[model samples]
Every structure is written in C-alpha cells, then in structure tokens.
Target: MEAFRNAVRMVINRSSDDQQLDCVLMASVQKQLTEVADAVTSVWPLAALSDLERRECAKTSAVRRFPTRSIVYDDDRNSNEANAYFVLEGRCTCMQRLRVRKMTTNGRNRFALIRDHDGHGQSHNLDTQKNVQTVYVKMSDLRPGSVFGLGERRSGRVVIATADVKCLLVPLSFLSKHNGSNIWGRTVCSLDGTNPTIEQSFRKFVVENRWEEYKKSLANDLFRKRRP
Candidate 1:
C-alpha cells in the first residue's frame, strides 16, 4: 500500500510546472483515496494510479476504448443498465433535447385567443406546450477530467465521441456503493460553466480586451429598440 502511494507521489513529482493544474488535480484525488484503503483511486481517467489500485479497480470496472462517433448514452431513457464513464482520452459531445417556453407579444394589449389555454379564455397567454428545442453541449471537448455517467444523470444527455476516445467505464452499482468516497461530484460538479480552459484562454482574453466595444454595441442596440 505504501509503495503504491509512493508511486502516485513519484508521478506527481515528475510532472513539469506547465502541468501544474494536472498535478493539483492528481494530488487532490490521491488525498481523497487515502480515506478508503480498498476503494478505487479517485484519479481522473487520464491520471496515473498505482498498478495495484488500477488492477483492483479493473476487476470490477473497465478501461474501454471507443471509436469516433460512438454513442455513450441516450437522452430521456431509463438508465437501468448504464455505465458511468470517465474520459481518459479523446473528445465527445453531449446532445440534449430541451423544451423551451417564452411569452411573446405582438405590440397589442388584447389577450390573444391563440394564447393561454388554462380555461381563462385570455388572449394574452399562448399555449406553448409543444415548444421543444435541442441543445448540444460538448463534454468540455472530451476533456480528460470530465465525468458523465448514468449515476450522474448522463442518461438524460446523449454523449457521442467526437474523436477516437478511451474511457474508464465503471458500473453504476459499484459507484453507488462507494458514493461516499467518490470525488466525482466534488471535482466535476464545481465547474462554473464559464471561463474557457487554458487552451481556449486567448479567445476569452480577446473578448475581455474588447469589452468596451461590446458594451457600446449592446447599448446602441438597446437604444435603437427603445426609439419610437
């Protein structure tokens, strides 16, 4: 056990400074794994785990390889036998069919009969029960650290490999049993859905630098809308 822990530490030490983020992520995972000796290591799919831990985990889990465009999950389906996947390599996109509803006006005051159907006979409200929309969200470009699985509600999101991909697949039942030691929620759930990664930082930087121009354009558009 000590040897395995040392091995993990060695890998962290060998990482270059440029890999600081990866190092931190690895260390954090290791720390969480220490709480449960027999539990599978909490390393991300791409991170290194001790040979012993890896082997033990594989006895119940699998490191599967997938071709490009493979479907990982389907939307709105019961995930009775679904597996949770941790991306070790390649990229995938999550597709979801969403229903959207919005109240719209045609610059008139009388309630439109084609609108609210709540038996109020009101004309201002419109029945929007059939407004369905589709949304496609890439899984952080198949980022190595992302976790999407049946247990994590991936059953409602369709995941498709955008590139040749490899992932660690674990049974949802096993994950549920060890849910206490699982850092999957803490690590992946904390992302704020904003701010690009380092590779995409330049785009965000450019946008920030041109904030004034964006503000002016927005203000001009709002002013135009308010004009008679």
Candidate 2:
C-alpha cells in the first residue's frame, strides 16, 4: 500500500511540473508576439493616419508616379457646332451610304410621312416621328470626297462645318494632313481659289510639323461653354 501511494505521488508531481513548463512556454511565446507587434507598429505608423489623409496621400502618390499625356493641337481651326470631322480608317459601303444620305437629307426642307393603319381603323399623320439619323466621324478618317457645310471660321484658318450640308464646300486638305495615303500631304481648302500658295503652305506646314489640328478643334468644341 505504501509503494502504491509513492507511485501515485510521483505521477502527480510530474503532471504539475509539465503544467508549469507549458505555462512558461506560453508566456514566452506571448512576449515574443508582443515584441513583433510593437516593431511593426513603430515601422509603419498607418494606425495613426486618418482615412482622408490616407486617401489623399495615395492619390497624390498615384498622380506623381503616373503622369497624364497632354493632347497637342496642330491647327487652330474650330468646327462649327454642327459640323464633325471623322477620320476614314478604311473604305466601306456603309460609309458611302451614310455620306450620300447626309448630303441628300441636308438640302431637304421637309420629309414625307408614312403610317400604318389597323383593320377598320383610320390612319393618322406620323410626321412627328421623323427619322433623324446620327452620323459618327472619327478624326483619323477625314479624307477627300468627305464634305463639309458652312460654319464659322476659327484660329489657324480652320472652319467648322457639318458633314451633312448642301453648299459651301471645303477641301479635305484644308482640314487634315495625310500621313501616308493618297490623301497624305494634302489639306482641305476653300473651293474658291482665293490663295493657292496659302493652301500649299498650309499642307507643307502640317506635314512638316506632324501636328494634328482636328483633335484640338474637337477638344475645344467639347469643353466650350454654352452661351445662355
């Protein structure tokens, strides 16, 4: 019975010692973790920053690291509010149809109305639902045979005209420079032979300068304030 008591006492003492060792290990681990956290906090003071300040700082940094490219204008001409210049990237049947339609529609003062009637019902005039087509022209696609209508003239002798118009035609060469196509090295000019040398000079200037005037005109148009 004495031997049995001694064995039980030995087991109890070992268990207590193991528990003490576990506590010491746990305390050491906690201390190490606290030190790591303190080091991180010291190195990065992000915790002290306000949300707005952080956002602003991030924005400024982004702006500084990545600057935006400024658009340059070759000519100073502005298109009229209604006129648009589009670049002809490639030839297509749809483009031809659109150009023809625009020209035809521009001269028309009024259009005919068509309406469908139900059985045993009377048809009414549908003139209010006039089909007005919107045309999109890109800056790179303006070429000879591209037409312009009358508008105000601006700086750089550039005139703005609607692509859809009846009279007052301007040559494609006067408005844009040809990079390396049949239209290259040309400028749109007034059909009225006012100044041949000026037209030639303008083309030469645009080609030599590698400047793009139409883009500037577009930018100016887009940002221009509307008069009340």
Candidate 3:
C-alpha cells in the first residue's frame, strides 16, 4: 500500500497536458473515478468496471491506431502521458527475447524473468562468467478487451502491434490528479483481481517465476522523479 501511495505521489507530481484536445472530456472521467474509487483496487484487464465507469473511461480515452509490427513502448525509456490502455480493436504482440553476448569466463549464467502488465514475458540475464546463451520468454497476444500499462514501467520496452490495432488510452496524469482522495488507487487495485484467490495465484505465478525485476520496473517507473 505504501508503494502504491508513493506511486500515486510520483504521478501527481508530474505535469499534465490539459491543453491537449484529448483532455476535453477528462473532467467527466475525474468525476466518475472519484465516485467509485473506494470500491476498487486495480483495474481488471477484463470485465471488472461498471458500465458507467467503462463509459467514462471511453469518454476520457483516445482511440489510437498502430500498424502491424509497430512498437508500443520501450523498456526503461520514458513512456508517454498515457498510462493505461483498453484494446478496442486488433491485436498486440509483446515478445521478450533474450540476446546473450559471449563472454570469456567460466563463471555461471543467471537469468531473471519478468512478465509485464501487458502479458509479455521478460527475462533479464546476468552472467558471472563469460558465456553465451539465447533465451526466449513466452509470447503474449493481447486482443480486444485487454487492459494494460496502468501503473507499469513501459519505458524502453517494446510492445508491437501484431496487426492493425486500435486502443483507448487513459493518461496517467488523470489518475494522479485525483489520487489525493485515495479512491483512485483502490479502484486500480480492485480490478487486478476479482477475488483474493485469483489475485494470490497471479502473484504466486510472478514470484515463483522470479519476476521481481519486472515488478521493480513498475515500482521504479512509478516512483522515479520527473521534471515538471
């Protein structure tokens, strides 16, 4: 909870593009989130929000199209204003491929795997000895109704459009702007899982798979300092 709170603080501390044409409807979105913030935690990628909430999200979000094989976000690089997404049409493929450079040592090879919020599997390799090995993480196919990127580290990572894709994106600033009430964060967490069991299972999968690096990416992204 403290981590989440800190993330909210980081987001709130950033500047917003209120003058953008896309922000015209943000007022309505703010109001809706304010009304329902207490009842939720994480926003579920599937069907967790109410009709009204969904409608408001749609109102505030902008529809964007990307060509096939286009990069959505890069790992460790600063992401754009938008922090969340709801796929409206088409598909996205997030692939985490490993490139091992041969080193001249006899140590050992250690690897850490991270599955990102968009369902992409990521593996970070650390070698004590100079060795060369190619590792491939699982592939994630994101389709319509998939919600992702909220509160996650997206900078320097690559998310590509597998096909022509359309998505409704909600800017991170919107959530930060209303986080003072604390309801906004709750709403987000509430949707990550409908029940504790499911949430636990999801968490277990991440932990057992040693996705701590992936989790840190999100934490670092959310808490890092930014210039206004």
Candidate 4:
C-alpha cells in the first residue's frame, strides 16, 4: 500500500500544475495502480480482484468505457488484404491491453532483439543498472515480445502488410548514433537460444533509419498489385 501511494505521488508530482486531469494521466495512474495490486494479490490470492480488477482499472483510466471491441485493419502482404483484431478479455501484469481502432493489410512480420548494457567501466555501480528495463518490440508495431524472428514459433508476429522489410533492433546508443555511424557493438541476439553479445561492426547507420519508409514502400507495392 505504501509503494502504491508513492507511485501515485510520483506520477502526480510529474504532472504539470495547470494541466487538466485527463484520460492519458488516468491511464498512467491506473497502470501503476495495477502493478501494486498485482504484487499484493500475489501473496493474498483470496483478495485477488480478477477480471473485475482489470475492467475497473480500464474504466478508471477513461472518461467513457464500453465492452472490448475488435480492431480491424487491412493486411497488406498477400495483396488479397487481411485484417486482425485484438480481443481484450483478461489482464496479467505482463500485457495490459488498451483499446484503439485502426486498419491493417497483409505482409511479412519482422522482429529484432535489443539488449542494452552499461559502459565499460560503469558496471560496478548499482545505480548504473537500477533503472534498466529491457523490452523487445515487433519491428512493425513496437509491441512488446519475448522472442524475435519469423514463423509462428516466435512469440511476436502481426502479419506482414508488405515486403521489403528491414528489421534491425539495436541499443538506443546505436539508434541515436552515439557510438558513431558504421560501428556496431557486441550485443546479444535472442534468435538463438544462447545469449551472446558478439562484437559486430557496421557503417552508415542513422539515428533514425528508414524503417517507416520501408513499411510504406511495402504497403504501396501490395496496394498496387491488388488494384484491378
């Protein structure tokens, strides 16, 4: 309960003084509150709020609430077009579903495993590692996942909307070009079961690469072919 209060205070402190309380802020608060609820419910299983907890959390975070609805979008890969829906039923601390509407098309899905590490001499300090939160996202949607690579075997995949996809997941350092362009550092790739950070090098990398452009090109190509 103390931790929950502190988390809420931290959130409130960070908000702008004049800013009106809004759904986004409420969502942030609810997420933190849910984290606390999970920790407490674990030890006292009988007190678990179960599905009601999730629904309440979602409602508290919104001005208006309704039953979870499927989000349909065209899939761009097959050129026949496809759609995917997200069903919000239950919630675990791991994946919290938020409702949103969008379109989709068919194409290949890609994944990248990114691992961040401390600088050469900074490993001894606890503060250096305390703030670390490692998460893997689908290259296309930036959705969190545990695995990377193709096929249903891999944990994360949202059908490909087009071809010409280049998925590269690296540390923020690499993405920000902090280590200089064309230089790749040793990082672990979860593609293989073994976690190894091998020193690899590259050139011509940008702070933000052409990922968006690549996705657009693939979508356009798929759309063109499907046109009669």
Candidate 5:
C-alpha cells in the first residue's frame, strides 16, 4: 500500500506542495490500488509483466492529468525514443492530421477535395488553392492500460484526451530489458491461453493493430477506466 502511494506521489508532480502522504488515507489508497490492478490485468501487454514489475513501473513513472480535449502528444515534438503512456484513468483519442487541397474542376466553379498523398502531386492542371486545410481524423479511442507516445504510426498524428485523463508516463524500456516476449516475437504468454477476451476485444483490436488496418499496435492498458 505504501509503495503504491509513493508511486502516485511520484507522478502527481507537486514536489513543492506540502500535501502529506500521511497514513490517514491508507485505507482509501489501498482500496484504490486494488481496483487499479484489476484494470491492469485486462490490459494484456502490461499484464505480461509480473505484478511486482508493474508496481515498480508505476513507482518510477511520472503521472500527469489532462483535461478534456488537451493534447497528450503531438507526433512532431512530443515524444522521445522511449516515451510512452499508460492510461490509469479516463480515456483518450488518437488523431492524424491530413492536408487537402480544394481543386477547381474544368475551369468552372465546382470544387473537389483532393488528397495530397505525395505533398507535391498536382491535379492534372486543375487550380489548387494555396490555402490548404489541415484536418484531423480519429484513429482510435484509447482506454485504460492503452500505451501510446512513441511517435506516431501515422505521420502528423497526436493523442488527445477525449475526457479528463490521467496517464502514467512509462519509458516502455521494459520491452528491451524485462519480462515478456519481444513485441514482434510470435511467442505468446501462456497466461493468454487458448482463447483471449480482454475489454471485449477493444484492447485486442489495438494490440493487434487492426483498427482501420493500422499496422502498428499500442503496448497495453494499465488499469481501469476510472481511478481515485
């Protein structure tokens, strides 16, 4: 119980604040930790870690809270090589940015939205407006234990809080240093067994990288949808 409270304090990031990590809240904090662990069990990748490793990960991590619609990561500048996030509370959304040109067709006033896949491609002499609009498309809705932030699978992508969110910032360095098979390795956790049913396949879908056929998968969730 004390270990987990220290973990929370480490992430709370109020080094200057005097709010004590007192014994007074022991009962409440212990109950919360138990609930958080239950959520992590369903988050398979994190689940691969032994219970002790998972707790250690939190104790060494940084925790941050983001209010609704705040940006958690911006593909261009937000992540370092090992930077990743594990949702401990609430949810988030991954969005990808696209730039499109409005093309004037057949010298008439009709306009069409044309994708600029190459960024330099022309529309067969059609007049392309200099003012290209930037749009963000929803890639996925992330819940607890959902790990993200190692740059974008899609260029110009970002993760944003769909609701107020609290995430434990993990380096994901454990992938190369600790328990479980390499993410790319075909070896399976004996624990996953013959059949897998986690978060009704939402987590599996993300882990399998199947959402809209995205070739990349997030590591896993860390806890339940809500936390104290």
Candidate 6:
C-alpha cells in the first residue's frame, strides 16, 4: 500500500519538478495496477477475460469502505447511483419493506366439484377458500465473496454495514442484459437478479435481521400509529 502511495507522490513530484519517468517509479505504478486487476478478477466472467481485459475493468472499478451502521446503498435515496458490489471484508444488512401475507389453506384430494340438482356443476373445479392477512417485513447480512445491488435496484432495499466493511464496486454494465453477455447467450442473471455469490454471502441475513422479533412487534407498532 505504501508503494502505491509513494508512486503517487513520485507523480506529484514529476509534475512539479518536470522530471522524467525513472525505472523504479514506473515499476511501482505498474505493480499496483496489476494487483488491482487481480482483485477485479474475483467477480465472475471477468476472470475469463484476457489480462488486458480485466485490467481495463480494474481501471474503471473502485474500492469502497464503510463504517459500521453506515448506509452502503439505499435504493430510494440512491436511484442515480447503481452498481454491483463484491465484498472484500466485514458485513452489511440489507433491508426493505415487503408485503407478507399469512394465509389459511385447505385443499382435499377430491378433484370433482359438487353437482347441482339437474347435473349442472359449478364453473370452477378447485375448492380452495381464501383468508389472508398482509403485513410488511424487511432486512439482511452480507459477507465476503458475497455480492448484491445488481438485481435489487429500485427495490426499496437499503444496505447498511453491520461491521466495518470493504468492497469492490463494479459498474452494472459488466453484467447487464442491455450491455453484456446475455446479449447473445442469455445465460447469466444480470442486475435484475441476485448472483449466486450474493446468495452465499448473505445466507444468514434473515436471521441477523431478527424476523421473529419484528413480527412480534409489528402489530403493536401499527396499532399505535393507526389509533391516533
């Protein structure tokens, strides 16, 4: 890391001193950029690209860090800023208000409906009754090798760091349907869907967000607001 800092300092000096590129300074900058490319390769499909290709990707990407409790992404507030994140360190919680319906279900093995007196029957064959109560729930935890935000945009989802976090921020264009590989093969899930790696990284998010605790309190919370 110090080498990267020194390389920048050297550039500053050369710009002011009108000095030429020396062998040592040139090597330092090249090495740092190469290291950055290695980190970019951790995301899928990019690894399959040639060295020059991924390095170009690295050039456009950035490393971002957030402190615990900081908002990493909020769809409502950050609509203009969109990208997929590759986790490098720590954890985050993803939250959203989702409508969840509690339903009472009853279905027997009988496929035929009861007929009327003149052999006339009901138009519908299924005999299921409906009783559902709707409520909202939200939240998650993210970890290393996990990715998010691609398929989650405009979803009212908010990602907050649960611990100090570090991530590789890659542009959405790399895997988007309009701009990327799915243009032909249509095999990969773009930002419109969660990546497999994101599934692994945030597997424990539901538990971390405490769904039961929220469910227990939701009714009381709504009553309090509605009564007034």
Considering TM-score, where higher is better, how would the candidates rank from best to worst? 5, 6, 1, 3, 2, 4
lDDT of 5 at 17: 46
Q: Estimate each model's TM-score.
A: 0.44, 0.21, 0.40, 0.15, 0.50, 0.50
How do the residues 1-228 of candidate 4 rate in per-residue lDDT, one tens digit apiece?
999999998888778542655766878887866653443233222134356643443333222112222212212232232111111222111111111112233653222222232455342333343333322222323121222221112222222222222221222321223223322121122332332112110011111224665878889999999999
Model 1 bad stretches (over 4 Å) = 1-53, 101-139, 153-155, 176-182, 191-228
Name the better of 2 and 3 by lDDT.
Answer: 3
The Cα RMSD in angstroms, rounded to one decimal, for candidate 5 relative to the true structure is 17.7
> Of 2 and 4, which scores higher on TM-score?
2
Per-residue CA lDDT of model 2 for 1-228, tens digit only, reads: 999999999999999999999999999866755543332223222224455533333332211011122111113223333322222121211111011011234433232212234365785444444463322222222232333222212223322222421121123332232123422222333522322233343334334323344566567787785534
Where is model 5 more than 4 Å wrong at Cα? 1-52, 106-129, 150-152, 184-228
Clashing pairs in 5: 11-63, 145-220, 145-221, 145-222, 146-221
**Runs in model 6 lying further than 4 Å from the true structure:** 1-35, 97-137, 177-228
For lDDT, candidate 2 versus 4, the one ahead is 2
User: Where's the lowest-lDDT run of ten residues in candidate 3?
Assistant: 38-47
Q: For candidate 5, lDDT tens digit of each residue in 1-228?
A: 999999898877664242554454776777666655655454567677887977765454556789998988786676344656778888898766545443454542222244434366653332455755655556668888566653324346678998999876656565446644455132233213322332223244333333533322222232332344
lDDT of 2: 0.33
TM-score of 2: 0.21
Q: Of the pair 3 and 5, which is ahead by lDDT?
A: 5
- Candidate order (lDDT): 6, 5, 1, 3, 2, 4
Model 4 spans with C-alpha error above 4 angstroms:
1-28, 31-228
Query: All predictions: root-mean-square deviation over Cα?
Result: 18.2, 27.1, 21.1, 21.5, 17.7, 15.7
The top-ranked prediction according to lDDT is 6
| Cα error of candidate 5 at position 130, Å | 1.5
